[model samples]
Target: MKDPANPTSRTPEDDRLRRRIGPTIRDVARMANVSIGTVSKALNNNGSLKAETRERVIAVANALGFRPNSLAQSLHRRHSFTVGLISNDSFGRFTMPIAEGLEACLADRQIAVFMCNATDDPERERQHVEQLLGKRVDGMVITARRADRRPGLDGALRGLPVIYVFSQSDDPEAVCLLPDDEGGARMAVEHLIGLGRQRIAHITGPERFEAVRLRRDGYRQALTAAGLAEGEGYYLSGDWSEKWGYDAAARLFAHGREPPDALFCGNDQIARGAADALRERGIAVPEDVAIVGFDNWNVMTEASRPPLTSVDLNLRALGREAGRRLIAMIDGTPMRGVSRLPCTLVIRESCGAKTDTLTGTEDYA
Candidate 1:
């Protein structure tokens, strides 16, 4: 199934728009591998973090030129530079990074964020929107739980300068920012081909997800480009779970002759499952098979025995873009449609790479 999403341009202007003025707690939290609130508590000596963790966080904060006094304090301006953040995702894995990215961009300008979790509930969303508007927040950033337009969303958000993250509105004129899923998937599969792996196969998430279709297209395009599209069943669809990977990989090897030498997974979890299944069958990773995953999630990527090579949708950049776009709109700049950020391929051991090979992110410099 196709996703109800669109893409936007990540041109040089977008990059410059995300550049901000000063350092904030968000900066320190990122440098110290902690949360923004954690940084505050650590600096004030008010929390229960491990001694070493706190110290490390402090050192990192200092190194990054962070000041405790500046934490959550607005710039010396007359107005409170507050913005409302409405998101339907509570898991934080996706929403948190995006929020942090938006915070980073806003923090540069000394803007405070008031976050409201909609939890995919329309009533809650309306309530939060009404509350933010009542508080007279400068503007708002809204994101859907599944990155698709929801009912009453447009109506509830009617008079505010709004920017949509990872989702779009029914209005063709709305400003949205989404990750380039098609491009990211293409980058991953092409990297595998570049590594001299010909017998490549793909296993991805539910067919209902637009990500699944886009990544699959990327995989197929890469294969066809290399004149290797003749293979059958090299593409498979399954649920977005490690168990699906395990089952799918096991079924492929049931043939017991000439299995694929490289596997491209839709997400990190499936990659881990596929790896585990391969290992159980005495198949050596990167020796007999190479793997690449999407999402570039650190825990899953790093925890795998050889680590995983995956795609990073750069939620931080996405959020930063959303914030910048909203600020521009609030400042009387004309904005329309989706502004898409490119995805990056972060290389690790699972691909048998000698060095990190990032495709769509940036130069090594």
Candidate 2:
């Protein structure tokens, strides 16, 4: 029998069924002593309302276990509240961090992200874009493994907001977010210069890459700023690999010429390879020759003997900024031009500096 004072009380089975059904917006409106529209406004964070009233509605909703129907809310707002992320990073090295950062930024706003990998295939990318467009995603983010300029999407997005992360777009009006390769390289070299290393050599990837060219320019600029001559044989350009680094280091020490006091490698793998080659030659790191690398890749940096001081591109931060800018564009704000985010120097034992010291900051512009 039901208790007279508690008419809603029911058996355990009935309570279980009620729990399954859950509470609705109407329940929240009734419990909060407000109209259904007021509850909708509070829950959806739409329309101006008294702060006290909003708080009360929220509290009552929480107590009643009320959850709004996302489909209904989206229909009312005319926004899918979803974003599409497209990438060509098959290895997940760059895409993963960017996606994580993008998700972190969008989650707070109750927006969802759909990730699609193009794997260097243009047809596949077009298909993904079309599918996302069909789903009516609010915006899209395009990324790539390398920070190179890529062609714009093939489809007519009807003025849909699109952001390029870790990639550049040929369109002058397209928003592109990239790591400041030149600035980062300059910072790395400046750090080595501050250590009083007079003779510095650069070992890097092929000249075809924009990153390689920018980093090379930065290295040269830093050296020139210090009144140091960039020696004829100081720059070695090759494929980005440990083998190239090892061979390049050997060449630097070849021809009975004076060896450099420091080496700035384009990537951590190369730096590790150079360190190994130096080890075989009985040259002590920092004491004899210091080294710095880009990418700050943990697998190579942490594993290297004496570790490695490296430049971190801050990819995650770039992604977060990309998300913010995309949302702004979606909200009718215009964003254009290229924005270069700063890089950080993660100091370890390799450069003879105090271990685990982090430094460097550049404005996003």
Candidate 3:
């Protein structure tokens, strides 16, 4: 839903273009039996028009799909009314819904979005940034994998009101919007604890990524809070993909020591692969070895034979918030650094066992 306080929806320019095509003020005035000036006043809310006549004109305009030329209006006012978006390759899938939600919210405010996929390449990202600047976008938002560490971004956007979405690096100067990774990790681990699995192993993404690092931290925190010392051998690092998940799971299963009673995968893709590996080894999920994943990516998790337990990172919210913040920055309102959105746990059949069954699994940090 579009927040009323900030009406900055996705692609404000596109929506305006849709409205500008038909039913000019002349047409509306003709239909309402009023002067074009009256119709203009009614549409723009600029000057006084008879209330009854205004209603009639509005009604006619509505029937005829008459819309104001927001792009032209913003141009006349010396505002680009456009936001630049730079995203990474993996996070690209999330851009659409977020963009859609943003557009829906910003409909009344009249703003538009310009998007670019940087594919995690510094040079390409730099080029895209330059292109957006050339286009005179009013503000910019980036769904960066490494918000602070990206080369040239800091210097390039020094004076621009830029907001980072999805991930943030260690630098404090970056204004960012991200999921509550710690909270999400805690939610997933606690769900496993609740399911009575004590010997839990984690297959995590590359430590270089901030979100992954936080999720790993959250897992350790959860284990510590429960009085369990996390095993040194319990963690496996891998790429955020199903192939890596499968490889890690196989490695764990083959390692001679007692197999972990459960697994916490870094993301849904890894979890899916882990599940396949377990199934291939004839291990029944939840009943034998439980599994939990991050990122509530619905395609695989929701449709799996036995649905997977996962965490919802609120990625769409992250996108929408980024858009809202970008609009604010363009409007000369600087937002606070580091805005975080809460994530929720989604339970399924993956962790079905009772919590008390795992005797040695208490308080591992």
Top candidate when judged by lDDT against the true structure: 2
What is the C-alpha lDDT profile of model 2 across 285-347, one tens digit per residue? Answer: 989999999998888998999889999988888888988998899899988889898888899
TM-score against native, each model: 0.76, 0.83, 0.76
| Candidate 2 Cα outliers beyond 4 Å, as residue runs | 1-69, 356-361
Candidates ranked, most accurate by lDDT first: 2, 1, 3
| The 10-residue segment with the lowest total lDDT in model 2 | 355-364
Task: Sort by TM-score, best first.
Answer: 2, 3, 1
**For residues 1-365, what per-residue lDDT tens digits would candidate 1 score against the true structure?**
22346345465655655454446678788777788878877886876888998898888877877664432333332234788988877877788888989999999877888999988787888899899877667788887555555443555666668888877777777777888777888888889899999999999988787778878888888888988763577788998889999888897777656689999999999999999999999999988999999998998999997899999988988888888877787778887776667888999999988748575753211
Alpha-carbon RMSD, each predicted model: 17.5, 5.8, 10.1
Candidate 3 ranges with C-alpha deviation above 4 Å: 1-39, 51-69, 78-80, 120-136, 144-148, 151-160, 169-171, 353-365
Can you give the lDDT of residue 88 in candidate 3? Answer: 82
In terms of lDDT, model 1 sits at 0.81
Indicate the residue-level lDDT of 263 in model 2. Answer: 97
lDDT of each: 0.81, 0.90, 0.75
Model 1 residue pairs with clashes: 8-338, 8-339, 8-340
- lDDT (10s digit) by residue, model 3, range 1-365: 55677777646665677566766778788889999888878877778777888888889999998887765666666777777777784665566656665666555577778878878777888898898887667777776544334432556865777777765535567776767777778777877776677888999888877778888888998898887778767899879888998999998888567888899988889999999999999989878998988877789788754788788766676677776666777778856567667777777788784322111121211
